[model samples]
Target: MMKEQKDNLFILVKSLSKSEKRQFKLYVGRLGVNEDSKFLMLFNILDKLSVYDESVILKKGIVKKQQLSNLKAHLYKQILISLRLNPSHKNIRIQIREQLDFATILYHKGLYKQSLKILDKAKTLAITNEEKNIAYEIVELEKVIESQYITRSLSTRADELIAQAKDLSLQNVLASKLSNLSLELYGLFLKTGYVKNDTEHKRVTQYFYDRLPEYDLHKMGFREKLWLYKAHLWYSFLTLDFIACYKYASKWVALFYENKDMIILNPVFFLKGNHYLLEALFYLRHYKKFKETLFNLEEITKEKWFPLDDNNESLAFLYINNNKFNLHFIEGDFKQGLPLIDNVLKQLEKYKNRIDEHHVMVFYYKIASMYFGAGENEKCIVFLEKIINNKSLQMRADLLSFSRILNLVAHYEAGLDYNLDVLIKSTYKFLIKMEDLYDVQKEFIKFLRGLGDIYPQEVKAAFIELHKKLKQFEHDPYQSRAFLYLDIISWLESKIENKPIDVIIRNKFESQVLKTTFN
Candidate 1:
């Protein structure tokens, strides 16, 4: 009895769209004998099943128990082949590979001239699309063919092939190194979050610069430069350098704009670059620029040629909607943003299999934040509980820590203080366990802990005192990240001023806009 998650074939069958399943059936039916084959029967059984029960599969009489594994594997491969033939799945990379496959077949059949011609066109297309690895493969194939089927210009052709291969190989190596460094930094950011103090900062700085490969910018192509910018962006993020993040993210997005055609060829990277740019702007509180960037991204997605594949669609939904929430947060219009929660949640459910748990939790946190700002403390607590109670969400320790802290605040605001002491203790302990107890969090917890002891008449004074204390770290490199997660200062101001949290935040936003406008 294989676990549902571990059953690859079952998962694949379940993931298929109706059109895709129809195509698969038609693909198998093309071979009249395969219409009733054991593998086809297995596919049908897996497709109809809501759960991957090996015993149920055996009872279906598709194949013998001992032979089931082989049959499942065959079905998986055939389904993939069908998908590969689907027109929507045939992007430039796949097209290039298809050409390479055709060339390889021809080369093996002694059609050397024909093979060389196909390889030449494929190498050009690959290079144009910045698929350097495949371009190198095409060049290597051409060289092999040239050695066996010599022409009058063999000497010059050999030199040209060798040069192209060398350049492509170098570019691929550089891209690989940069991509590896970027992935490592991203993993570190996820595992422990941003560097907490100067010691962690120095360690991460050293780790980043040590692995960052040297390359001449002028000589680098789109693929190499894309990875280079990504590495820098991750490094800036880990070091809590918002300006640097903006710089690298801007460069990343600009690279695509400079080469507009590459946007279609590398839509995922384009979407990610824009997302990071928006994130950096959000952190910087650059409202004008953030709005402009978000608008531009939304418009880009609406363009005629933009990809609408499932993966791209899921990411577009994730990044665009996530930032739309951020936009509302920056403007302090949480009430207006509340309507978006239902749609976002619906999309999250629709793409649950595509989006990861970490992002889903982030969405929950944003929803909770919106509710909190809108003065809907009970609603806020409900969403925060989703994140706080997620025991298996191991990534984004920072998010988990803030979710608990926000949960405590929501409870206090809603006057659910009967269990406040117990909640405070658990949250403090959890923060300590996560090693995420920054000064801001400590101050917050300390204030909440003493709330029960304060007289009702002195509560406003307590709020003012707590506001003064937390305001000092509003710009602190390490501690300020906590404020980005939960805007305690505004919450305190709302309490002291006897106003709603949204009113306080909206006033602050208006003042900042005025200041920016005057400046």
Candidate 2:
């Protein structure tokens, strides 16, 4: 049996809308083919399947084992051709490529003049759209045709094409190197998360500077600038410098807005740039700017021409809702955000096939945090257990560590202490295995472990003492992330003041806002 997500044909079929399926059928029958064509029959069979079962496909007798492979390949190619012909799928890049294909055919048929005309138009369209790599190919083809067939402007044509090719090649090389560097930095962030200390920080800084290209910023084109900012954004994120991350992410999103036409052509990059920008604002506690950025993104995505295909729709839902939840956390209004939890979980199931495992786990963590802030300790434990029990999550060691620490805290809060000893021991062992024990975690676990020894009258004093100790780590770069995941300080304040946690956080935020305003 083929893995459903890994099976390209089945996934594509599953992704098609009702209208697209109807169009595919109409396209297949346009040539007056027999209804029983093997490829068409195979397509219908595969489309109807709930999963990719090869045995069931073979059992249908549509094609023999030896012929099944050929039929599948044919059906796949036909589907792509049908999609390319669809108006909804046609973009500037696709249109330029189509013209290039036609020009190649004309050249092979000895129609050199017609081919050259089409190539000229196609090359202009490609360059206008920043499709420089394809434009370079067009220039190369033009050079070959001029050399083989005499033209009226032969004296200047070769020189013009040569200059264009040289410029395009340099731009393409810059884009390629910057894109590769950006991808590597993203991989490093996913694999290990933030740099743990001075040693790790220096190591990551060295790696990033080694791969970064030297360039004149003003001379770089839009594509090159986008990749350059992306590389810098990821590097800043890995260093846990939220301010720098915001700076680069703002530049990235601004580039698209400055060239408004690029938004429609490159919707994915635009959406992602806004997502990262919102994330940085959230971490820096810029509640006003975070709200502004989020609202702007929502408006842009809802535009009439913005692409809302299934894949992008899933992404919009993910990024938009993730920040929505974050906003509630920013104001510490957990109860108000409760309405979004069920809706987000339902969409998670709907998009399970498309979203990755790591992202899904991330959702669970956010949900658990929401429940924790709402003071529903038992429910918080339930959600945290989902992250705790996930054995396959290899990336994001920070999330795993925080989940464990939060789990113990939730257990202690809910008075579910019968198994607390066993849970704390397991968490300690895992922390040692990961070597990610920050001062925050060490003190948190130590406090929880000594709960049985503290006198009832001295509990408030104990809370005050622990709160004072954790305050120092709140400013420590590496340790601050632990607090971001679980606000132990606010929880302790609530205990000492005999007030709700959300009230404590909201009051504190307002006071800080006033201080900044007056200053």
Candidate 3:
């Protein structure tokens, strides 16, 4: 009678909830407290251990295909009946379709919000039916969404989802489910947004950040593991998250540097170089000690070859930024750098894929600046046209800056005969809309400087107004354009009322014009 009564109690516990069911499993499986008390304590304990191990094996992807197939066959039938009764419970269907359909789409598209939304709606629908049987499935899918978001540094939603997933995953004999979810969360964090934001407010939500390394070190065999370090490095660079950036970069470098021979052909090297260059640029901009490291990096990069695609093209952009720094700030033979720029663009173009559209536009922009600097106006105009025509270039602040400068140069060289007014006005409009007032003033200065040579007092007043506006940014690096302004001033001042033009101004103008013929 006692044994039969215990069996009835066990059946009641199993139907209550997942958490209650787990408590029952633990009490029965671990404490040797079976309904059938006929067994010796040790025998009951051993049986419980066997059941625990069986649960572990089932959870760890170790179950036989036939066994899972049989289990799934029965479970699906129950799930279908539950769904039929509570068809409105999207959470039920989402849970069942997670790994199979609905959740997979969310994962593929990086849409975590939609995944959880579907699961929550389904859960609400399932509440009406006690036998929904979707409790386990919903729990697992919810965990995946939560873990994935947490790993990606989508901290805004992570904490809430994690709390909910953890509660559900830990319910009942869901230890195996919890363990799998934990591993996945750890792995996805490593694989995606490994680094959190640089700002203080953003880091507060990450509860599991500290536990990740412990988890990662244990599951190092996972292929996507390497990407965790890479993602962290990229995130650091993106958010300017320096301390974490350096920490992860050192870890990543150490990982590959020792086994450099093994992964020399791997895509990670390009990723590493990208990391190094970006970090170097950050340190080079903000700190001083990294210069020597930056110098040695150039040598390491020389030994490496890049394929002509997006990754290699990123290296090309790094080269462009570094070269611009060298040209404008370092005070070297800027012309000597042109060959290297040309070589990179040629390599990118060799791929013949449109993936390099932005890179190519950048190349054209740089070349235009270089030619304009050399007074090769016609050549500058050709490259400027390339930049203006590329449809892929996003009209961001940087692109707007480049566009305005190029347009000013193009219009000045094209002269009034070419209806250059249209180009100049369009450039002014773009800069004004972007709130790039400083560039707009520079364009105006260039325009007045170009025309001030021909029309004296009226254009001279325009130049004076531009100089007044420009004076505000006197320490600005772009004030270097003042050199041209000075030249224009000198030329205008040197002109006598009756003189044809100063011989010196004529000579300077002719020399500038001559360079354009073959450039």
Candidate 4:
């Protein structure tokens, strides 16, 4: 019976169009097979994905709209079938029954409410108690969608769906689903502008942190296993448990050696870059002694570990964030970063004009961020303004925040305070709104502090208000919350006193806060 199914799967893959092949790969990914047949099937699936990607590129180049739509439909159906067919792989099956295919499509279409509704149903479709593990994707995706939509001014329905999803997830219908959901929620809270007092943020991280080490991170193959460890790493980070985060992250890094073949099969180098950057950033902000640890990772790889094309440029941003200029840019020689950024920009421009406006917007924002980092301030402002002016409020929220925060500092430094007060006011409103939704609160607060620093007299009242809010947070103390309070208060003090963050503050943060979580 299994042999017949394998043969049929191969045939189905071959008969499908290029788009169908890509969709099939997603489904094929769900089923587990340790034997020769599964391996062969996986190979076939990869071949199909390659073909499909080629076709997509070629079709895209030719500006073939009709053909593209046809290909997309074919691919979409394949995705649906694949998602629907993986019962033996419990997680995949639950995702299917939960209607992830439909939800994903709706999300792409900008119909977040509809997508979330399907995802909500997906949370309840699991059978065995373990099946509940898959619901987290829906829950987290819903939060992302909600944040995206709310930031834009869409109807705020994400909380309702999240509530529904969380209720089911806590019942233990599926372990992996619950774990993944908790992690996803943690990420969403961080991504959105949520405060540490945000109940959802606290609850999700606490639940997952307490349940760490139960996930056998080595069991579920590379991609899946990497994600599991990644979740634990994040949970540890949120709980201000740097030791725990680092321990899991180090274990995950070591797994790269044992399952090197699997590591080579995925584009995890980018992930490693991000992980290292996170460590470096945390250490820099906290343990200044480990600041040199940032330079440890190399610039390029001889190992073609993954099939990422020009996107490596985006990955290099991790290095950039770590301030490891030599690895990516030797003596300011940006030959590598420049070309990569250019390629990504071209892709974004092409997608913007043709494929999808929303995708174009995302790429546009990424390009703008690159430009800002590269000191192309004029170009950054142009793209940033364009995105902020986009009709979508959700879109405008991030774009506005990014543009205003960076440029606001420059303007203040230059003493170009024409209407700076109004800009700061609007910015605070946006950040506060985001904070309420459990969105990017840490970043928003950081920006608020930055504004207070650049124009102390102008933002004094607002800074005091923010300080008051931070003070109230002391009543509700999670590890992450404690860190946030300290960071914010330090920022406030620096702003009030017209001073800079000294080494002592950094040392205390590293020793008393960050190291406690990740070491």
Best by lDDT: 1
Instruction: Judge candidate 3 against the unseen true structure and give its global Cα lDDT, from 0 to 1.
Output: 0.46
Residue 38 local lDDT, model 4: 30
* lDDT, candidates in the order shown: 0.91, 0.89, 0.46, 0.50
Count backbone clashes in candidate 2.
0
| Native-structure RMSD, model 3 | 24.0
Off by over 4 Å in 2: 1-6, 49-59, 64-70, 153-155, 516-519
Q: What TM-score, computed on C-alpha atoms, does each candidate reach? A: 0.95, 0.94, 0.39, 0.43
* Candidate 2 lDDT tens digits, 357-412: 88888988899888888888899888889888887768588899899998998888
Candidate 4 residue lDDT tens string, 1-519: 422222333334444445544545555555553334433334454355523343444443433554645554554455556634534223435445548768988999999778877876665553222244455666667777777766443444655666756665544433455457556745553464232444756675676656554444333434455556667666666555556656776666666656655343344454563454345345324334234444333333333444332244334433334343222221222333445566556645432223345445545555554453354556655665666667653442333455555455434433656766776677667656654322234544455446635664667666666666665554343423333212445545555666543333434444665555776
Residue 434 of model 3 has an lDDT of: 59
Compose the digit string of candidate 1's lDDT tens values, residues 324-394: 99999999999999899999999998887789999998999999999999889999999888888777768
Q: What does the lDDT come to for candidate 4?
A: 0.50
For each predicted model, how many residue pairs clash, with residues at least 3 apart or on different chains? 0, 0, 6, 31
Model 2, poorest ten-residue lDDT window?
Answer: 2-11
Ranking, lDDT, top scorer first: 1, 2, 4, 3
Candidate number that wins on TM-score, 2 or 4: 2
What is the C-alpha local distance difference test score of candidate 1?
Answer: 0.91
Residue 200, model 2: lDDT of: 92
User: lDDT tens string, model 3, 1-519?
Assistant: 422222222222222334433443454456554555322222223234412233433444534645754544443343344433332333333444443356557756989877777767666544332213354466566767677676545675567556655544433223333334345543443333222223422452253344333333453422233445655554454343456667766666566555554233343454454455445444433223244445544555545442333344446445534444333222223345456556655665543332346545655666665554444567767777777766665533545455555556455544633655566567667656755454435545465446634554575465455556555554443332333222233223333222222344445445644664556
